[model samples]
Target: MRKRYAAQNLLFISAAVVLFAITSCKKDRTTTNNNTPVTATPTKLGLYEEAQTDNDTVYREVFITVTQIGTLTVPDSLSDQVFDTGSGGMVIDAHYILPANMITSTGFNFTGDSTVVDGITITNQKHIIQYGDDNNSTATVSGNLCYASVTIGVTNGNIVVKRLPFYMYYKSVDNNGKALPPHEFDVFGANSGYDVTFPNNAFITSPFSYFDPGTGLTKGFKMAALGTANFSDQNEVPLTPDVITLGLTADDLSSASGFSMSQLTESPPYGYQPYIPATITYNGTIVNDASILFDTGTNADNYLEDPSLNSRNAVVLPTNAAVSVSTTSGFKYAYTVGKLDNLTYVENPQYSGVPVSIFSLNFFFDNEYMLDFTDHKLGVKSN
Candidate 1:
């Protein structure tokens, strides 16, 4: 399940576990040239989207495309099925997906299915339904499934592997080390194509937004390095995610060729996303319990923006106070949230009572945001 937001941008998908009912699929159809997995290689993908704020300020989304225009060949049963051509759902952490509505081309919509190839099995898979806004949107899908042969070319795509052979988003395991099968949202991520993928250990963004046509800069790298790396440019600060083990799929049961998602990753494919500590201080009231996701996706700066606990509520700064955020990685940012001139709440209650703060695409301002998946740490280097 996947969704993207405007004011409260969220790149991470929440985990869900349930049973799905399988429906039969028929007819083969050709998928559009969409997210195709690349062979592992050091490929330079250009930056993605750019957004504008109320004050007319602009911010660029930081994701680098991992796929190229490629064909998606579907089975005969799904041939007449319509695939999403515009505004399909985004990948969870890194997979492409669609809701029942997006694929209604020939009046065929999303339904649970059981797919088996040469005794390899991934069954009871269903499409995701999105609810709420970015600050707190939720996805619902069932699991006990792996390896969907979607047109995206099973298990091969760049950053947002919008296809099958689903890899990420498994959240359960059995005593014998078999995956309980949570949900398969991603079938892409540095699997076969090593060339375009970042070199292991580390890679750093060029400390500039993708759309920032710098006045005097011309190195042409919005992002860089990795060994001690899941990187290309070379490194200093280490970035890694804190493993939470939301779900697990035994390596043996995961592939027909005995392929395990861990083969391409420094950690088990089940590791939770990495999060770092952030100390948020507003009006001298410091909240040391805050945590921040050092993600390459868009950020809402702080909850002080349009994304508060709920969509129906106005998320203004506390008393319009000045705010300061200090990360454990050693960067401090100061800003102030002003009263709103426009107020329109959506009655969305996804994050109704939870607190949130994010490092926006522009938050890493004048420094390098380093990610070290192997070590589970995030590093920041002053530019």
Candidate 2:
């Protein structure tokens, strides 16, 4: 029997159990290979929805890409199997056919029957889908897969499987170590990819009305991080609704990976929030000129550390300030963050928590943005 788990309201984190702040930060939008488009046509797309985990409630969507391995026939009925995007849907436990050319990391375990023919490797793998707006959101897939010989794709390229029965195993504790009941729901799958571009003034013209079916949560796109960081330690505990975090410290940035501490920052604490060349604006005001890590996975909420240092103020605007953000590509977007939302902040011992002085914003799919891994750029969609 599956261990039943009770769902908890985890839309936002509790102030008492402060874990870590997750944000994705990238360098200023730079068009590499000058004059080339930075967006990739998404291979697949599915409607976004919210799910409840033991620790939190998350917005999730799944994308699938099926390629022919040899001569195996994938049922034509596969495309008809899509999951509902309703609030009550269950978390998906779907499988993926590992591509022969794909290089997987140590994060996954392979299982079940496997066969290789014609220099093609066929294996079943499990991939957990999350509501993500980044280019590398679905890069890592985990699970023990079971399958037989497969065929290589000849005609069908991508398929969006919707409204299907999907089950996920979950267990929770009532602040004590007690087991919870099992749950189930339906899910959909499809080939997932992002085709985004950040042309000038894109943020000003994009849509911001996003309604969360699970909690009736509505939000608009307001700000974006110039860069992002997940964790200093790759093996750190994962957030319930896993997200792409902003990269802090000198080591987090790919461009400054080889720099020494002395070459990174010249602060009293040295390396305490190694600088990032970024900026932030609130209601047309340049409140922050550097060190702001915009988080899209959360909400339009803002945080201000009590008794913040002058340097901290230089990078993040106070919660009392009018709320909004403008992008360098010439796009102006606004949001609403209440004045009472200020967090009685404290620094993190792990150097992993959202810094008391650092600012975090939520704008996942609130406004369309194209994430291009090929060019290492996050382009705000201006259509």
Candidate 3:
């Protein structure tokens, strides 16, 4: 009787131990912070090819989406600077118009996800377009939409990136209206990198003024364009006007000797007073009666040539021609130029002055020029 009673008690204790062990494991798993779910690695969206309009509008009209965040390497001079992908990213925008037939889908899974992650915010954005009526000088069209919030590391020289990942989605349909399978961008990764660097400090002055669109208030803008130049066609011909204007010496030309500035043949544009007369030598040829404007509102590299200058100066560059640039400060750089056919030149009747040619991205990036917004000056270095 004693042995049997002991056996029964042993069995009961073993079952209780098993039950306790099972309950403890369930409790630990449910409360553990380490078990939180993480988002899966993203994939790239699509690839694009450069396209042109009948009027010579140049666009990268291809469809693409970023699937991953990849590393961007900068110049060795900046090698000491460590850029964190999660926190140091900047917003990237592609202002483009898509085709009517293009198929698109929103990743519902990402809908409420943090628009900003590790300093990267990927979001959809738009711009407003005000069309001009018949009474107005010109009519406007729809503005562009883009994907924003990609982070980047700014380095000198060529940007060297090894593992920047982009997850994008795309689709093509058959003759029927049925939808096709979605595909991600895998090839666009090759051309997605950018090269950024700084220039010599001596070339520019500081305490620049910038325009705040949000405030509509003019404040000190830290960035400035060193000068402006125009692009030529594939044949190396100037796409627009040949006459170059030199804004008065206060901007740059004051101390430099050579050439002459003259009063305008007619009342100049509304905001512009007669520039203190000046002339400049361009491409070894002396040009007079030119209007020079150091426009901060302009992109610092290459911009579309004004249409008013179109018929005025159409000097073609030789096939595979290279254009050289020089400034009164003795800054110099050169690049092969290409024509932008469809870029429209806005000729506002209220502003009767010939459009000021813009020197923007083409020149800055090609020349390895850099703008220090914090210091408020433009700098250039050898490429």
Candidate 4:
């Protein structure tokens, strides 16, 4: 099942969860391309420096890509075969093909002349549909595409083929609740090098509304709809009705490998709540509840930002251990507490060289944690 976190209503009150705060500190010297050490003043503030009203202004965007593999043959008599992006690749439409058709049954017995070839297996199916205003205007499929192979028939003879085109709409929104113009693109296949393919004579209807670039709102369409048609009957027959519901898939955060949260025995004695047990080593010392953020967006090496604990360029350690970050976005950089750790100062310039302690997301290195927005709790576990 898919879990939804209502973060807007929940107030994050972890004093340890330091918001962006600025302080003055000394600058660090870095080596140039020729390995010559160059001293430069640090002015950029880290994310957890202090809490700012405009923090919420930053919005995160998620992109899901779906691809269709193998070949499907549909007779000219039957209507379009409806497929849905159910939760985690689960198919919701009645016309959905199941594994039984390929694994057990001889072929798929849908309306018209639709049939699965001998070697093909229906490994998975999903409907990439979404809800909300943009969704109301345009239709699309979200999530990764299904995968399968042609195990039986020849690539050419006795088979009808048509490449299905996948389409999606994109809308960029600012912090304010304002609509942005819509963008459209076809969801192409990942490795097959082709866009999409389905049976010949199959009807394709995409749920996408044309966006007015000037106003960033829907031009004319309302909510996009999905339905199957029986082309042979002359009358357009709808397969299933479209409704707003949360699609559940077997793939979820809990199912991800190497993710766990546990209680720690050794914890800080004062001003810290030990909700989850985790260990981060800095200069060979372990720190707990070090105000770690599991950001799927950070793209830098290790950096410290506490202005009150360490020298401007002084090393910032977890107080003890090693580190890891989430790989959802991209595993390009793994921020860690190196030997000469120090917090950077932002805000005032006079307090340079002052030792300060800052919070960072690099503390959760190689650990799996859960953010329970329902109960407003964060659980951490390490493997």
Candidate 5:
């Protein structure tokens, strides 16, 4: 996902707080395998009478000030302060309060200093936080507290406090028809784990690898290129024309053979139209194409949007109950349960459901992939 900003309707702390609650809470925490606690449950505190009274006083004073000053205004005097003034004097600030009884299922910890986490580096000034892909899906944020503080180097850079946003894009790979582990991404940085390389060309981004379920041969795929163009904060960006392409190759096409390199196409026949291809599967007997787009982020197991096709029988799934399938990447996707309509043998009928199963990112796991901007293709390879 990429971030977009509005010049006039700039994001502020208050707006960010509201947007955070809406977008973050909308995600069903049950889908993530990571142990990070998503939300905290409230509990009654057995505080002493004196402590309660003190808390009440503090709350009243803060509330009154907030109401009077308005949440959007920043004190001019405070804005002039420098980074060395200490953590409390930054341009923006946000507070995260965990529920009293909250317990993390998977331990959450930071491994980097304040200068960077994931891949974004925050300066001492205020920055606008935006979220989403080319589609209209997005969230905006402003203020100082958008990120967490991580300690940097010593001397003038000893303790660096950064603003950490809650959302980021995650990338993964699927070989043949299996899903692989996902790789964490920074969304806006160069070293975001995406690598593009060719055996005869200089290595760039990482590549994801896997064995084709159809042929039982090891293969690799990676990103060929990526870029952003023609989008605005007020408009919804469609997923075609300006799109991402992937490059793929395998050692061999036969289950009993060794290996080889070949070009693979994954996009739907619509040529990167509004419909997003989400999943592909080969059940030893049949292969199905399940494509769909959902609001969930990288944690989504199967984010596909398309119909299904039977590889063995060369048939398509019935159009009754949309078949929900899972990939090796642990992503779950649903294919349209309807049969192909208006069968035409013409070269290109604008849109045709040849029952050809198309696969998306939901198929790879623990493998590195690349988006080649120069060639307009995606590449994948295994570690």
Candidate 6:
């Protein structure tokens, strides 16, 4: 009798211990983790963080900062130094763009038990912050409903991420469609395994007033082909005409099939830019397989063409003569250069190897640029 009684008590104690362990785990999972606070720093931009939901579903969140034209009260974290001012005398700094390579969920690690994740979309936004368009510009940043580890890479040694307040124009809400607070970047402190180091300081000067002293022009602004400055997004219509209708490239496209090499190039996009094939023809001179830097960062219409050309003055591309850019999927982007004769013939870009041409900010007015990663295709849409 004594032996039987002892065995019963032992069984009860073991059961109790198991129950306690299970309960403790439940508490750990349900409650907000103190060690993993939502307010952590050093966020990994492309990784998604788990955000709360109303039901059994768990949703992920990511933060995106766009360059918008308006009264942007620079966050103290980013206002480290005075960048520049807008045409309206607003404090200006270069705009922050999500790393083109890091913004997708191509290699995201899923933690849940289920293999399928319920993806949600939030629409009817009053604006698209990218182009500062309030209406008509229907832009969708698509991917695997990327799980934003809610990580913001605010600092990395000497490279500090100074950004204007993140404007989530198209996706300012959570996967569950919850509106996110402005500048609500989620980074998991130092433990986040990712460290972002940019080749250049994106926020050095105001995107609106970013003056490339090398070329010598000003205005992080809406400029006419003749070179005028205007920065007013009031009433959803800024002076900078929303020229190109941008689209997020599909997820399955990549460079493996000789489509686009952007994903395989470098850690950053600006450093690598978009690599494409082109033929620049001027004054009856045609150079095929030409090297060109199709940069959207440049704001002026007059760009830096290869200085090797004979005509020092701006070469007038005869009417009906368009610079043809060969793109992935057999798409061709043509920039009809008949409009203006303001190109400044300068020394070829110091970029190693070949002489190159640049398609700057003004180029957007004439053509649509597409940088698709997962889909592995880069295309140019001629307007």
Q: Report the number of the highest-lDDT candidate.
A: 1
Which candidate tops TM-score? 1
Per-residue alpha-carbon lDDT of candidate 6 for residues 256-365, written as tens digits (9 for 90 to 100): 32333333133132222234555665545565665455443323332434545554344444455545555333545455553333233332323211244555444444
lDDT of 4 by residue, 234-271 (tens): 23322222111111112212436323432223221111
Query: Of the pair 3 and 5, which is ahead by TM-score?
Result: 3
- Backbone clash tally (model 3): 63
Per-residue error (Å), model 3, residue 143:
7.6
Clashes of 4: 63
* Candidate 5 to truth, TM: 0.21
How displaced is residue 186 in candidate 2, in Å? 13
Q: Poorest 10 consecutive residues of model 2 by lDDT?
A: 201-210
Give the distance in Å from residue 215's predicted Cα in candidate 5 to where it truly belongs: 32
CA lDDT of every candidate: 0.30, 0.25, 0.23, 0.23, 0.23, 0.26
Candidate 3, residue 1: CA error in Å? Answer: 96
State in Å the error of residue 101, model 1: 12
The TM-score of predicted model 3 comes to 0.27
Off by over 4 Å in 2: 1-44, 48-277, 281-296, 299-320, 324-332, 339-352, 355-366, 381-383
Better of 1 and 4 by lDDT: 1
In candidate 4, how many Å is residue 82 off? 32
Residue 361 displacement in candidate 4 (angstroms) = 8.9
Q: Give each model a TM-score.
A: 0.42, 0.31, 0.27, 0.22, 0.21, 0.33
lDDT of model 2 at position 339? 42
lDDT of 2: 0.25
